[model samples]
Target: MTKRWHSLQNDRPFRPITLLPVTIAFSSGILMGFAPAPLNFFPLAWVALAPLWVLLFTPSKAKAQGEKNESKRPFFLFSFSFGISFVWGVGYHGLALSWITGLHPLTWLGVPWLASVAIVLFCWGFITVWGAVLVALWAWLMHRLESVGVKGKGEDDAALLSVHASTPWHHLEPLLRSLRRVLLGTALWCGLEWLWSLGPLDWTALAYTQSPGNLAVLHFGQISGATGVTAAIVAVNGLLAEAWMNGQQLAVSRQRSAVSSQQLKTQNSKLKTIALLVSATILFIAVHLLGAVLWLQPIAPSNTTALKVGIIQGNVPTRIKLGSDGIRRAMEGYTNGYLALAAQGVDAVLTPEGALPFLWNEPNKLRSPLYQAVLEKGAVLWLGTFTAQKGGIARSLLTITPNGATTSRYDKIKLVPLGEYIPFQAALGGIINLLSPITENGQPGAFHQQFDTPFGRAIASICYDSAFPEVFRTQAAAGGQFILTASNLDPYSEVLMAQHQAQDIMRAIETDRWAVRATNTGYSSIVDPHGHIEWRSQPRTYQTHAATIFRRETQTLYVRWGDWLTPSLLVLGAITVLFQRRSLRS
Candidate 1:
């Protein structure tokens, strides 16, 4: 069996070779879907790219022929397949939800399916191109390492040969040079994340899925933002990849030495390999256990006065939401819900994004009614509404005091691209109009805003805005103690979307602030400062959830420092790669 496995590894083309990694990647993704919070700590993200690494570093005709015709097709196919599989595993949940909810029912059929598939392909195409770039970079670095005479190949030459005959040192070099790569990669990924946060479709992220699982790690997030979470994810994956590579090398080396050496040498190598594996396993277990312990702990609010808050899920349809009557209905529903909550003696009432449906500038039809309700009930009202700003349409969350005083407004800085505003709209306005829903381009808002309540200052964000850590960080820094996230999830109401919504628990944990998330069509909840869900509504339910609010504690180290460790490692990683490449050139 071992021989056959080795034979297959050695003979297979890169396309076929990626099968295991792809399978593992997909399985990991599904596992993430099942238990997104706990299993998310597995560090399986880079495993998706394992095949790409193998393909690029493997001894192939392309490496020898220096740009042969046959190599091009195989390389492209390998990248394309890997991209499709990886992206499909990562993003198919959103697609499935889109279909199930009839948001794009046509997508359930041929045309939409093809279009969705094409979109996925287009997104992955960039990833594929990036992978190719990384491959070329790795090759250059490895050649440098070899040229500089980095010594000590482990006894596992045979196993390494099975994977990549020529670039046997690729794995070893990356491990030894990990510090540099970690630094560079961390910086690069974080920078990219920062840029991606600026995009309008704001909520999607690798760390968001893991938000609900571990509170302490998330507590560290309040200070660091999602960048901190990203760093942790990368660290675990890098460590695991290193450990696996080390184990493989040790195992192969021991086998080779056993065949050719004295009994003592064989015993020593075997012991070393076992020790390495054991250490890796121990580290992995310890990290997850620590995270779990942190997650399970209860958050003690500073004040006990416990404010009663009501979250109204309007469940307004997107098409209606775009129209005037839809806006009126949303406002009416929210106003009615607030009145009902006031009758129940709720201290405050919350509504989802675009609860007013119509742009705020539209003649004050809903405002007077909403103002009257707030004044009569003497209950604070937090509403998600849109406004016509100088740049374009802007989404905002407005907090009205019990006396009907409009206390503060938080404009959503992060806007969805096609849905809110087209990228490069000035140049591609025509194309964008045909493809997107933004009849009038959406505008970006200020990064942070706060509303002063009788209890304390509250920070609020619209749907996509909650995904960006910087917004929260800035708010927190500006003395916002509690977070109110208003979202309209009606368009993508699915178990997956619910799961995705639950990920916001991490935000609470990261910042040590309690969060009241009110969404359209369910998944509404109250999260404690520790990132645990105190209470949540059922999926697809147009109901109101009432919970006692809590105050945030002091800021964490992560907040003060902000992804310091990860970014440093990334810089080091980049430098090491560059140095190695230079040495090879020399």
Candidate 2:
């Protein structure tokens, strides 16, 4: 009877729950959202993972002393499906991706108002929950690697570092184990992040949360892409976690404390020294600050050239953007802004995506006023329009020369999953059309980007292209002097616009080129090489302002090499996994 009751207790027929980990992990996810723009609580990201770390390392009663299967699993006592990891995912993405709710109206096209809201909420929650699951899985990987590093033989007692007191390995083991934990944590983070960047669901990179606000750490992004910044952040977080775990242990000399051998005394001293070093590194940001000066500083004045670039923000209404008839109003707004900017003697005038409201080839057919007016002013006009491709229309940058001729055309490579191109149109197409009228697909362009402009050789990152670092890096490496991004963020909230601009700032700093944005709705701004905003337009405003932006010929470590650090760390992680497996077997 007692054995049966004990077995049933573990099952918990009434309710099987671990409340603290669930609540804490979920709260940590909410805090993670506040680290990025619109909230801009920049400090939240540093400590956001602390709760989850505690969850991973803390010894629950059931976890510390339990049956073999229960104690042996990663995140002990927390069953995979019933654990706090999934709950954390819910809390994290719910707040971070609240923007999904705005797309609810699209579903009304096929269903009733109430039904649409229900469907939208279901979809939004489902997606956020799914993403949260991925994050939880990643946390499990990190904790497993950490456990394996500490316990030499994983199968034996599930204790951290089971060592004979007199063995020399134990003396040096503490220090090596701590360092290994940090590396393992960092590598696991980068590896999972790399996997996330593979497909249409690649928007939630943790590195973007650090940009434009975390100035001290932003310098690392210059040498490496955003991944470099992420690695540094993860390393610091990992060190802090290690410190929390081993805060009680102190180094003791045999002569001063007890009757230990001299060799053991020296080993303890070495262990203490290592702990202090790790603590100092995490608490101090000196190395990061120095890297900032060496790699982040802008080019000398003599080596740089400046151009007067104008950004046009036309606050087109939501109704106009969703309707075909709004093309006239959109064109009129862009034309007036273009001529006024031309009057300022701007070198080039950039308009947002869909500024012209028609095809580049058919601009004259819509009685297009800007093409001829811009040519008359002798300023290069770069705007977004549909360029006819082999199969369909490509969302591209249409660059007009002084003679009103389309000399350069750079097509958008990365298309938004549902917005630009609907995947598997034959099957998902009919279903998607019922939700939103987006019937056609936008064809993807080739990767090589080189745009010829009168002012200088520039590159155009069509709105969606801003998210992918490789797109802009390729342009910079190919001798792109200036980077211009054109986005048409109509009907989206200020939160969305700021998120997009935050990404632009990182691109500017990474490429060491001033990034000028021209958005149709708002938040058109210029970010310099040092990640400073030169000038910005207010949200939902119709105006054209020109900022003097600098052009650079130099290529940054990130721009030249492109995410080399991630691969290097992956190799390190593979080696750790090998040793960990071997230890587990023994």
Candidate 3:
């Protein structure tokens, strides 16, 4: 059986018609998608990528079989790797981002039902393809590096094809090469994630997969934001992939080798595998140990006092919330909820984004009964309101005191593309009109804006703003005490809310600050500095949740350095690859 398997592998190239690679890649992606909410089967994240890695790191069958079509081999392998990667990406992102379809039934925007469906699908497919393209690029580059000897050769290629295995240093070289490969592959993955997060669509990071589970590993976020956790994940997956590939390659080498040298090769292979396994195990343990240290680190107390805050969920539907009658209903709901919560002796009351559904400086807002109620109850309110900006209106979070004065206002900086504004408006503005009501794109706020509340200085994030860690990190670095994120998730499902909560949890751990989230229609939550969801309100409910969240001023390593680990590793990998190629040529 072993002889037959080895002969089969050595004689023929990998056949795509068999569908093994495609199936494994697609299944792995689907399995990995469950690592985050709402499924949250996070253990899948560790092993799901192993199959893909095995396929990626295995010696290209074309080269192994001495194919005559040398010109077509590179493009064939590149295209094959990219196709498999895109399939995997499709499965993973398609499952993870299925909630995007909740934006359907866009008749509210006067868009035809067919056009609305097309728009939503376009958004979903576009994002999924974008994410998959990144993964494909990473795989292609990783494969290119492997083939060029930057990451070294497979066990069969080194031990069977090459004469270097006869050298005295063969044993040590195999282990060293495996170590370098894992490090380089992991670093490149981390770098890809880091660069992706800087773009407009930054959702669905690998780190968030552990956000819902694996609290121990999730603690690493404090070291380098989400990228730290991503590095750890990719490292483990790469190690597993390497181990699997080595075993397969070793099996093939044993089958084809001469009887006398077989024993020596077998023993040496065992030693190399054992060494690599031991090294991998130690590396994994060290990651968790550092995470434990950071997780258990005590956050120092702040001079500012804790604030008893109230979060109001109005449960208003997206369509109705904009209508005249819906406006009255929402106004009444927020007004009543605020008064009730303030009457309960809460220090301040919070509302979801667009609670008032009107311009901040408009007469409708200035004449709000809530202003009088704030004075009557001596309460401070953080109202998510719209404000006039230079180009258009800004989604803003405003702090209103008992005196009806707007003390501090934080305009949301990260506006949702297409949802808030059209991308490349110069070219596509005339063609895209799904969101016809929004004739002009919403203007984003300045990045350096300060957020001050009656309780203390706070980091204000409005809805989509929470997805970007740099936003919160910048505020935290500037001495912002606590995080306050207000979101309006009326039409979307609880999946989005849960995912948003996960985002806030990671932000909390990264910055070592308490996070308070206020959302319309569900998932109003308060997360502690330790990434614990202390209190979470029910979904699709009109209610008020009050909790005492402390103001924290402690700056974590991630907060101070801001995602430095991955980029550093990436640079190291580049330098190593450059030098290795130089040495090989000389």
Candidate 4:
């Protein structure tokens, strides 16, 4: 028998999987991530994770059919992850951030054509690769948790441990068993996202994918912050994944049974149908219930103050934003927008990041026009510009008071990895001109920047700083009543505009602050405390509007406590992984 089996194994060619699941995994990861971007068909995010369910079953299916589950080599699992990452990277990060290539005359100037393209692609590649690794890590954790859930006893000590291994759970009904996956998957995914959602590599959270479009879903930001919303979205995806896996396993069990094919009528179908129905219903209740608790219509505290401010969009072209001509043109456009808003009776006007490009030797030279505008209108002016510091340049938000005094300046704290401040410039500077010596690099500033405005205590943010919730939370904790952010979206396409708008909306919801965003290209908007988009500008359009923004002294639970969900998730995931590993080994 051994000889026969050996001969049979040699005779049959190996096939761990066919092309279908492989295609499914790649397509699902990319599509799920892409749904959050330009097209924003948010519903797809729920099922987008279903393809990864294949990974969970592939090994078990192979085992049940008496095929090798897969090669035991350590690298095989990692290589599988590499494939997952490549496709995901191509579809989501690559497409979402392709605007990096539009860095234009500067990128194109300092290098050969191919090198410039490479420079643009470096970030997308680095992030995609990092994301791929994280996806693989999530898969590993999922498997570990699965083992813990279904296998309480050692695989070797199989003394009829349960009625059956194939059921949704050995001891619980299908609904309860499937709910376990929702918990496990949500925890594991949140753990990984928490690890990455900081500093330079911090580009996304599952919550942002559903933003503005799903206002009810977004209110989760108020309680658990973005991580909570992310957990909820991932949980729905995970339950669906479990349903797919459980259904496939059930079919495999039926196929392998010795009874006649027609004897068993797929007894678990009703159970599975109910489980799915229950899971979907729970998610629906969750979103709306949380929305009601954290709705934008929170009764205004007696201290709530309303400030009408002007939001201006310059719509400057990418090439000119940094050039001398571009600088003058951006200022002229901003001046006109400021005047227009001033005429409309706004108390203050906010301009997008780099609305006034600072000249090399004269750091405050651009302040003249802003000072003049503030003095003439007798209204506050918040404008974005770059200031020359000792080492390099710092992106700053200057608050020009009505008395012609540029009183408050907040330099941007978080800098972009490649675009704003190249990593390891010291080592790479000597090698192949990596420093971009002529280019203005940024210096990190204070963690929180807040000022007293005519309306209330206002906080300021530069373009990318708003991506990190802690930045806004810190300011909110420091008594900031309203949030003001400035951004220049000229180099990128409309995809970034939407992606960025979603992030600012989340900040507004998280901190319960009325957020007003000013953009050089587009997507300037006022986001209410409940995360609703009160008013937003179109992409690449030169427009300005005054919206009544109420400043709230009340802070939300998330803003007060900071991100409690992520740490709790990390702890829960660690215990599960350790317990499962021990159980499996024993």
Q: Write the per-residue lDDT of candidate 2 for residues 169-246, one digit (tens) a residue.
A: 655555556667667777777777777665556555677777668765676777788898778766776666655544
Residue-pair clash count for candidate 3: 0
Positional deviation of 437 in candidate 1, in angstroms? 4.8
**TM-score of model 2 vs. true structure:** 0.86
All models: lDDT? 0.57, 0.70, 0.79, 0.68
- Taking the tens digit of each residue's C-alpha lDDT, what string does model 1 give over 1-586? 3333244345334334345544554454454444343335423442433333332232222232322222355344343323433443353233322323334433422345666555545544443343233323333333333323221122132322333335645434333443343344445545555655654443435466455654445544554566666655544444444444444444444455345444544454344445444544564455456556656666665447477889998877775665677666776777778778888888888888877776664357345587778877798888788777887778878777876666677788777555577788779999866654347577888764666777688767777666666676666767777888988766564654455455567656666678899888767888877666778787765677677886664676555565565466556655666675564444
User: For each candidate, what TM-score against the reference?
Assistant: 0.76, 0.86, 0.92, 0.84
Report per-prediction Cα RMSD to one decimal: 6.2, 5.4, 2.9, 5.3
Q: Which stretches of candidate 4 lie over 4 Å from their true place?
A: 1-18, 58-82, 104-114, 144-170, 173-182, 255-273, 296-304, 359-363, 432-438, 577-586
Best model per lDDT: 3
Most TM-score-accurate candidate: 3
**Candidate 4 lDDT tens digits, 125-189:** 77666666666667655544555443333211111123344544433444444555566677877
Q: How many pairs collide in each candidate, listed in order?
A: 25, 1, 0, 0
Off by over 4 Å in 3: 1-18, 60-78, 151-168, 298-304, 434-440
Q: Rank order by TM-score, top first?
A: 3, 2, 4, 1
